[model samples]
Target: MPSNTDISKLKELYESLDRLKESGEDVVAEIRKEINNIELQYLKENLFPEMMKTLSRKISWLRCSVDMNLQFNGEKQLDYSFCKSGSTVFIRDKYECNCPNEDILEESEMDSNNLEIITSTSNQTDAHDTPKRSKTYTLRVEFPNGKVFQGNVVSDTYVAVIKEINPEKVDSVGLSHAGVAVVSQTLDSKYAKYQKPIGGGWYVMTNSSTKAKGFDLKTISDELELELKISLVPLNNSEEAIPIMGISESERHRIRVTFLDGRTICPMKVLEALVEVVKYAGVDRVRELGINCCADNLILKNPAPRYKKLCKPVGNGWLCNTCSDTITKFNQITEISQKLNLGIKVELV
Candidate 1:
């Protein structure tokens, strides 16, 4: 059987077929064919490979058992060897023969080499054992409009989770990167030891000796005894980020944001959250909220160096000092939400 992750993907794919049908697209047959291809891919890449590994281990164990039984029963010494052909393992015996059959001798030599390779693989498997099964975790996605979507997802890579949650936007490079970064940051904060900081500011999470790009969401969920809730916020286009305490310095650690319509942008720093709000609320509306437009410190056309570090470009060659503590950012978001009549929420996690 395919893993839960693969099953979820298939389910989503099937659901999309229904959506396509409703949209009057005649590609239902094409999509069904694509689904079949995906299923075959999953079988070959995941299920079949896993089954082969298990079968190989069992065969090795049984062969050893048979050899021990033969020796204990006082049977004559017999050569036991196996060769892999395609997906099958063939066991054969090599006996001493004075016959001049060159073909037989060559086949025996090939089988012997295969046996050695299998033995080495079996030894390595014994040392490492099988990989741990991925655990299923409850996933909750909170949209900016207070809408919530809930589902069960397997503990896998951040990219995989996003694909399951928002399959439609998986192809969007900006949203995919933003979603992965948000999920990675949350996992890093909770399970720092399991996360490896790789190039491009991405974090790979794993519990095994081998490095993996997927974090164990099930472990975190189990520890907290709660479903993993991901809040989608909004961000401006020109927003940038600055590292703060207890957060990763990587650019990928930027807080993920999306438009109210669910279009996501690149994640930005807390300092840029205010810029996003100001852009959304319009400069005139922001000034109406008791903010001085001519001030050289905070929201102004030209700011001093001290305040400039905390500022970001907000169109029309204007700069706004949005860089501040998390609490301040939250308060600003709240204020903008109230004054502009927008339901905006910016959370650090």
Candidate 2:
């Protein structure tokens, strides 16, 4: 039989083990908290915008969940019906697909906790803390380069939505061109659809909504006579800066383009050219082009082939040849006919 001292020592050892286990658990909980912080920062920095999630409000770590869904052959279906269904559902973790179709799709986790994932949603809630309710829409476009960009659509107004659509089957788009339209549908299905010039820019809206059904302006015209309000939404990265392609913003607002010399312009052509330059040479090159502001000024001043400037004096101002001609047109300065004779009398007063 063990002595009293041995029993006491055994009890002390058990207490020590208990303390160690508690300490180990505390350390694990602390590490988990740090990991959550890192994950939240990464989502805020990269995932939210890329995924097209409305981030008007702040998300709570305890209350937030990472809702996700699976799409097979372009149709969304439920993987686990137990998961919540709502646009504003807080997904505790990312989605996982362990079904036989795993080879068709990929699976990933949002957190170490492995929380349940949402498959689909019919409604949206304020993910952010903002009081205003926002709806989520999708904007799909097939680019001229055979590339397709589909994501969340932002912008409450139709004009803003059109601007958000990316370029399609073309290099550039411009609003300043003779035939440019930022309308809701196709152009010619009606009475030879014409472009109407509006104050900020030109729009191709119809009196009836029937013409706005199909994506094509002309085809939509054949169906509906909807009232459309097209306008020049600022473009930074497409051809002629016109609506050759569509662009969309989160809200219907204007984009301001600024030059290096603090000069701002909203011309559709210039915006298109700027976008083309960026596409070919890259965005960094665009910044370098802005740095070369003098070159742009030269292009503006010389709008003709072999355009040249002649120096001339006007009323207290030095005008170029073009300005000089306009000022002296009425007061014709024919020639200087001051003839001085060799023996001319010198009149001294």
Candidate 3:
């Protein structure tokens, strides 16, 4: 790797660990947690589907939408609940945001108490000047533990409270004003540019006094249960998505995508290249990890027998479960092969 050493959430993460260590929490526990997070058998290292499953609390990451209430100043903003769905979602700041409302006029505890609707009117001579946006974003984050907290994210430039998180335990994930952007996949390096998703998601709240009030998620109200669901993509982040079309597969010939690291990646995994603005190296072109520098480079195997156990034999290579969709053709080998081919290849290590 041009850059890669150890996994550390950030300087703040280490500081949190120090705090936890002072409290008698084993630091080794934190290290092991990171390893497990990175080593999880993802859909070809595709963090989106699994993330969707974890956030949505569903078996399959295929559903279209979830039940969520988007209230503005106290009234529902959208005509219907969030009906749009995607592979991933983002809760970040964007300059050209057509996303409903960028600024928050006012925010109160999720209640029907006294509320007001405020709009801006420009009565100045210079019409080129944009109107003043809201100053504060009252952020009320509810948890599965029947507990809710109130806070705010600055309108234009702001950071709530950033803290470290265990990637393995996303169910207990919550939102706070703290500025930590996302839950990283590693605790080895502090640089977030190389974070698992390449970009962060969780806003790590680090105020020592800001204790979580309610108990951990236990019995969630049926009405609030849907609020926990997360779609495959956030409506805002979908704009940059690359379309994966005309996917073809077969037993005699196949296609799939793979990273330069030789790790298998699902279809959407290709879109991840957008994070670094790099051209995706299809599976067929990428050699296994350590091909040029390792002594095992020349070695080859007859995986015809061993590989079948892991994936269905297709075209010239075995298909990964993530890339192979046997949705309709269970018995047809060619159909299965064609369906499984992701226009990628894998050189076994």
Candidate 4:
């Protein structure tokens, strides 16, 4: 409210919405949308654009670790095979890194043989304050075709300056890395094994180009066979997340999570929250979970009797089966009235 709106009015609005929600009124979304509109108006409606700008900045550059292999000062040309190798297998690419490297390193086609690794004092800094010429980093990335690619997030400059580029790789997902069970490799490993997971796993990247190759929405969709589109949903911008916790149900891909507090959330946001929860407890904890939610009450009643279906009455009630059954219970009721105790009939007509 920016300390501008009247406090009493704001409190009244909040309480009214809470009451409506508690009473099982299905107007929460509409009410929340209105509230967002009000806040957006208060912000001069720049919230959407500003949020986009912030998200763009965060995705612009990502940082991570990488592996590097470089042989200094060798043959004029470089030749190498980029393929999966070792207990820790990494994907390969035809053309390697696009990051800037030393200027002396010459560029050539991927098939060129008799290559040399170029090193320059300016390209690297040594322990003794001396410049040495070796720089390399293995970046993590996934191709559009769902193949993971990991190599030096090096620049053209670095590749051109280095030589003796014959390279081979080993597979990490298979026994090449370790003949360990899935449980041991996943849960017992030093770190989460990105390889051999259903969904793509996390990867390391040292430079911008490498970071670009890491798991992204496209990579996920390709690996998981699910379509994904980055979207900006208009969530409540209030500093407080609406406190809600509930059982979630998914029937025909329509999921609903109803909190004990009676707040119902759509599956999308519920799934988002679940991601955070899973991260906190680890995947194993989440796999062992089941959710419960409140069910709606149902009341059953017999069909009403028609006048044409009624038979002649035996006493004070009609003889139709439905009508007679209803009258019999009351007619046979014990008399709490003093008149009935005196043998005066208290009739229910």
Best by TM-score: 1
Per-model tally of clashing residue pairs: 2, 43, 44, 35
Shift of residue 60 alpha carbon in model 2, Å = 20
> By TM-score, how accurate is candidate 1?
0.26
Candidate 4 overall lDDT versus native: 0.28
Q: What lDDT does model 2 reach? A: 0.29
Per-residue CA lDDT of model 1 for 224-284, tens digit only, reads 3334445222222232321111112331223334557775543444555667777887765
**Ranked candidates (lDDT, high to low):** 1, 2, 4, 3
Question: Worst lDDT window (10 residues) for model 4?
Answer: 291-300
- The 10-residue segment with the lowest total lDDT in model 3: 213-222
CA deviation > 4 Å runs, candidate 1: 1-258, 264-268, 291-297
Error of 1 at 337 (Å): 1.6
Question: Order of candidates by TM-score, top first?
Answer: 1, 3, 2, 4
1-349: candidate 4 lDDT, tens digit per residue: 2222322333456667877886655667666666656554534433345556895687556442222222212234322221111212322223344444332122211112221222243356667886544333333333345544323333221122111111110111111112222111133233333222322231221122322222222233332343322211112232332211111221112123333345543333222222222233333322233211011101112222121122122222212111222112122221111212322222221
TM-score, candidate number 3 = 0.21
